[model samples]
Target: MTTITTNPFPVNHPLTFHRVAQPSPPTPFNSANSKHNTHPLTAYTYSTKHAEPKLSATSHEDQPLLFLLRQRKTEEAWLTYSQSTRLPGSTCLSRLVCQLSYQNTKEGFTRAQTIIQRLRDERQLHRLDANSLGLLAVSAVKAGHTLYATSIIKSMLRSGYLPHVKAWSAVVSRLAASGDDGPTEALRLFNSVIRRVRRVADPAIAADARPDTAAYNAVLNACANLGNTGKFLQLFDEMPEFDVKPDVLTYNIMIKLCARADRKDLLVFVLDRILDEGIDPCMTTFHSLLAAYVGFGDLETAEKMVQAMREGRRDLCRILKDSNWENSENADEVFVKLLPRSKISSDHDPPLLPKEYAPDSRIYTTLMKGYMKEGRVSDVVQMLEAMRHQRDSTSHPDHVTYTTVVSTLVKAGSMDRARQVLAEMARVGVPANRITYNILLKGYCQQLQLEKAKELVREMADDASIEPDVVSYNILIDGCILIDDSAGALAYFNEMRTRGIAPSKVSYTTLMKAFALTGQPKLAHKVFDEMLKDPRVKVDLVAWNMLVEGYSRLGLVEEAKKIIQNMKENDFYPDVATYGSLANGIALARKPGEALLLWNEVKERCGQKKVEDSSSSAPPLKPDEGLLDTLADICVRAAFFKKALEIVACMEENGIPPNKTKFTKIYVEMHSRMFTSKHASKARQDRRMERKRAAEAFKFWLGLPNSYYGSEWRLEPDDGDDYSTDSF
Candidate 1:
């Protein structure tokens, strides 16, 4: 153990410098007799042999005085505590308190103890005020010393020196708002204070120590921050027990928590209590109420709340006028009487209350959202007009309002109207965001307007300075598939990857679907293989089902079967779609026996069978339309008329009445092939001839002979030339 000190004095110098390290042994810094020992062991020390040469002349006599300038640490307080008896260390104590107030806890508390000892020596310990102690406690908390802070507060309270409510509130607020263990610590401190307050015999001292509304509100806000509704309600109910009254903020907090939890009943109960107490609801109260009603989609109730808010504001204004309080400065007392605990400032004049309850843009936006949900387009337009006529700039329609309007119109398939809304958004200086443009993209895609969708993508990049995202590329790919433009879909897919936007599962699925529809099963499988090789994409059951359906569509039943087996091996279950695809493929392959076996399996799994009794009523297994139609056609083709009758019976039993026109056409085709149609009705024969003519016209449009099957349309070379970049 090497002894070291900044003061280069030998250990024999007793009063000259006291920080000499004893060669005996090291002990905990706390165990050192700080009072008698004089020099407390500090963290940083140096051996004499290793001490810097410049520090040789540094005198040990001024060590205590030199520590006063030490910027960091509690050394100055300790030095002042040990020496300098004539001079009061009030400034040093204040500086130490400031440094310790919510900073390094271990060091702060230690320094605070030294300051307390010095104050004790001066006989001024009891003279410390509530504000000074409260600040000390708060500072301790900032240093993550909650227990120490709690002890300070508890000591003050027990001594009958009730800390200022603001101090208690600040400490509670900080403790309760901390990440994990804060609320627990705050609760413990609160319980201790409450216990102490109740035990106080003197009413004046008890009142002084008792927490006020603000302190309670701070703790309540902590509960609200966590969204713990149960804890919030329990704490709220305890307020009256403590003789504390719930103010406007209390009710506001309760309302917000109830809205977030979607507890409409609790909200109503709280609102009723507020009304019974004659509490004037503030703007936040109405805002929360409106949000709850709108979320519930009870537009009528939401509208009523808006009306009530207007009436309430008007009533408040009438009371102000009837009281003859012209200016807010003179009206502060009057307003407080009318609205208890109301915060009114004397510095600035407030805006006059509106003569009528004119709803602001936020309210209108909320109402418009409700209308849009109910598909009330006309009502949304009317609200937009109302928003534009607002008397205050704060009530002006904002970007969110316009974005919502554009989205609603797009969903309603009013592309032209949606475009007009977009134009109006730009005119109002509300730039269209990616979502706004994406909505328009969807609208055009629904109409198979690919050219317009492409134009929007280009405009988003070039004009709006917004790069197209994965969703934009996904939409473009989907739009191409909708119009059977496989080449366009491929080009968009490649462009997305080239632009460093990885293709999503939806992108891959769309490409596969396009290939399947174009009589290209091989290309669809190739796409599936590529998707599996990419680690970034998580392959889902839908992707597997797409692959199975592609093979099934090509009349490759064995290949589809293999795909299903592979799905099970990979821990992916085959759903209704998998079985349906396999059955369709087998039936189309002219393997009636295999199709029958698969249908039986489907019936068993669905817990359904042929209805033995015509009148026996219970709903049948609800198969999707695609599966039902395919099975029905297969039965009709196999000439299993009884099975076809069974299909019809189940269809009717399940409330899914078969399409008579479709069944009739299948029946007629089977009949015409088996025999001459001499007995057919004239209308039926004429319809059959009309279908033949339509098929011929379709063949002509494809530029194929009557029996030709292979037809592929390639894109013009110049189509993608302009959009090529480094991504190519």
Candidate 2:
């Protein structure tokens, strides 16, 4: 076996100890002497090479050294027996005392062992060894006393037993999990254990027992949490040395670690490895994959994964059914179709199964969540039907699951399905949550049913006494703004404050979008300033994008510029969208210098090497003929002649040609931004011009003449055109 060295005492945890002396030597045992061989001949041996015990360099060696290596503080225990003048109990009693003492007070580890010796005579315990040491270690580690845990582990080995990978694993796992301390030492301990387990070759027990591989797997899981992917990968390759088989847990751990590290290549690689290893990955494995795809909003991949899950669920159902059908009386465990036979035919009340399989509650709830992710309204109804069909073994369906399905359907634009989910929840006598009411209210708002949304909001507090969260208020305010009811939006906003529910980032974002859409910069800025009091809300890229799009739509370039400064001050740097917003907003506002500064900063942050040139902005000169062309298009539609003329002159001075569609569009739009009266009655004028013949064709290919209509709308094509790059 490899020479052991590391001390187990946790010096880092403030109350933990520091050893001042070398641990006492192990009790001497003459393993080679014929008369001294007191153990059953059937006791596990290191080698079967010789008829008599021929010292195995690995599992067993000279008894004194093995004893010494495993020894903890037995010298104190041995002395306490002599000093007390009372009979020390049997070895069994001694160990029981040690266990109880360690469990109660870890600060007195030496005293605990002394009590064990004083009580030893009654228990009559045998000498401890590897197998027992590993089991005791599992308990000790669980209790969070590392020193006592390590001592007992070594104590077993001191009685002429070498620790197997199990004890080593127990100690390593405990040390790693006690996170206030570092992981490096625990990892080092694991490596030494692996080497020691390897060097000690078992004749047959190693094959059936599988101490090395199982221990290695547990350590791998611990290692995966540390973000040390390189070391983890290396360990993966080295796992075969001890003939340990890789299991599903091993692959799952590696897959999750890769996802956390953002190593997509390795994640897919390990996924394939899971298939090759012939281990079926669990839901947890798929959850990690699903979350990873969703994190960056990789919509295509997320959709594909959802599709795969839907298809695979059918296969899983077939497999589960097949497994159940295959089970016979001779089978070690009866694998029913996830339900026991008694439950199927029970006229009387039956024993309830686990929460996961219990009808009408947790199980159906989980299935509903899966359906919502896949946008499977049909499947959701089927699962709810299944829940209703099955008699609930114990508790009834709770409101949490009922409302979750409702909210999901509402968000997916399936108002009928949302109402159906809510109705089923009510039929089951499940209480409606604030979430359920909020979801339906938001849905009504989305459908432009503002009065109904307002009525529900009032009912929530007055009739139901359910306090609404920020989402409930935001949705109503948004709906009000959508229907040109700014007064309603403002009233809802005030009510949100009065209710003592702090507005979230979503609340601020929704209000800002409403203001930007209505060209109310001052109101939007007021809400944004209020949001600053809450640190939870950060000015993210989407927030800046909204401002850019909003200001651009209204031709308020100065307002957009101020928003950019605020975004940067909050430490939110510009992305590709930031540049697009600036370029579009500045062109509308007729500010080339401001747009140029934004474009330059975008280049610097993204590095010109990575980001390709976007056609939205021109280098050196900010607002070019193309920009004027865009502005003129907006002007012609809005019927703002003065803004159109200003744009044309700006392009002309910059030596750029004003395009035909843009100029004609702008001239027509000048008639619109002032349609109601000869004054700046812009709304009616722009609406009439927008319906014109020639203006329609030019704006179709690009977004609107002003604001970006879609998220990530680009003038240039994206490089991720090949869907295959992500799938494999």
Candidate 3:
């Protein structure tokens, strides 16, 4: 075993724990006890097989095993019992072993055999004894390797050992599972066990319950499983008379027989008996219920059960994982079929509807939904094409499926491909749903193709077969708004209400966004009112962000605060969006202290715990990363240089570089503004500017224009007396 010492241990399973350091003899532990342990559960040690680093001599740390084994108290006892002693261990390993043995419950007794193989690899092969060997034989027999199982059994006999009656019960039970119920050969095996037990001495004979009775039950079940209804009935009739008290497994098999036979009447009959006997139906039982509901078209119930299985609400890892097919419409149904009906349930009847049971349609729709959710139009189309080839027997996909793909493509902003997919769907006789039409409408609206979008809308409305929902109307309204046609959006919103379709948050937000875009806050506020009036309308993050951003940009600080306060009242906590506005708006209003406070809050909320331990503080609000740079320029406009400098300092402290082109332009403007505001004489300023331009003039005089050189005025200069140095 690898030692468990050191900071990092490299091992797959950490259950093999050991100690790290040396100490005085192990003692009892208490809060006030000596400092000997690092953690209660943590163990560290070195490999016994290899030389390792020694523990530090200074620290007094005890090994965990010493304490666990009670070294000081039980040292002599352990030495006395050394040869016969079993090392103490946690029960965790025992539980793990039991769990490993139950890997395959339904497929036969192969579980024990599989564990033996693992044990053999782990060099623990000696763990296999008469009982385990018997289980291995049972697994082989049920796996249809009867010859191998026989060989194993013979080997047991040769070793002067055989499984007890209990082990014999397991072997006989597995043999009976192989459908070899031709005669009472199984009865002979049971009788053989009786005779052998009688021959054993009384002390050895008095072990666990007689394994012969277990063999009896196995034999009886074999008869039932073989479809010998007459024989099964005979056994059932004789079971009570034979004094065989049916165990849980025996009745479970009976329940299974009913479900497998698809004899619904017998199924229900067996269900009542199970309940009368007060037997609990596990996940396998509920799986059988799901199967029964499959042919009945109660998909909702089936889906509900499936959800329960998926969510781990039931102990179904053994039940569903082994039985249910992955990604199949009838996967849940198969699980149900394995189960027998139940009078009692683990959960209340859930209102889940399993979608259409058509495996092909269900799979196709599911993939399409996933693609739509991910905005992967291309993948959606590819999956649809494959489904079309399988089901339609044509070159292209069905219209409905194709339409779904096309609609998803449009939503994903793949307009060209969406149109292509649309053509293909139309070719395949798949009519589009409202969502499909909406995708095309939104795409056209974005491209400002009003005529095409309107045409499709009209087509949808004219068809009584197609019901236009809120999304359909919203798409058209959004298209209008995108093209700066707020009038069109307003008309569509009204048209939807008139048509008895309620406006969604999207409907209101689209109009609000349009108003904000046009710098019409009043109009936006009106839409906000309309949204508030509808109890069902809940504004999304995008809507609130738009209002906050728009109000901030206009420097309406008080109104922006009110919006934030309202959002808080509505229990909508401010995110980065609201904070950015708070920082920029306050900065723009020349309230640098307030701006600084808001900045601190943003950091405290977003970066307090983070930046304290962080390698660097918040990044300076980059023009690209944030819009607060506008507030920095506004500071220059408001003539608050000190406050603007403070903002720069904060940005720098946060590692933000304030390299503002706008601020530079404003600086130049500010200089000009200051001079002009002072009413400084232009000529007086001109004299100072003339002195500054002397060097530039000297360079210009040497590099005179070619045209000027050709000019007579430049070639023949006036008298030096007339052209003074100042004139030159």
> By lDDT, who's the top model here?
1
Per-residue lDDT of 572-618 in model 1, one digit per residue for the tens? 76777887788788777877666666666556545534655534232
| Order of quality (lDDT) | 1, 2, 3
Best by TM-score: 1
The total number of steric clashes, by the backbone 3 Å criterion, in model 1 comes to 4
lDDT of 2: 0.52
Return the TM-score for each candidate structure.
0.47, 0.42, 0.38
Listed per candidate, the RMSD to the true structure in angstroms reads 21.2, 19.3, 29.4
Write the residue-wise lDDT of candidate 3 on 1-728 in tens digits. Answer: 11111111112322222223222221121124524333211222223574434433321222333343344333332333233323222221121222223222423234334434444345443233343344455545545444445444444433324344444566556656643232244544544544444444542322332443465677666655564455555555555533566665665566555544544333433434444466554434444555553434444434554555435353322232323323333322322433423322423232222221223344345445555666666667677756656633432455556666766776667788886776655565666677677778778887788998887777777852676788988878777777887777788889988887778788888878777766676678888888876754556666776787667766677888788888877766677667676656665566654564454544455444545565533342222235346445555555445445555655666676776566656544442222222334677557545432332232232243223345211323323222111210
Deviation in angstroms for 670 in model 2?
Answer: 15
True lDDT of residue 205, candidate 2: 32
Candidate 1: residue pairs that collide: 101-139, 102-139, 102-142, 102-143
lDDT of 2 by residue, 647-712 (tens): 555556657776756454443333222212333246745654543323333333223442233232
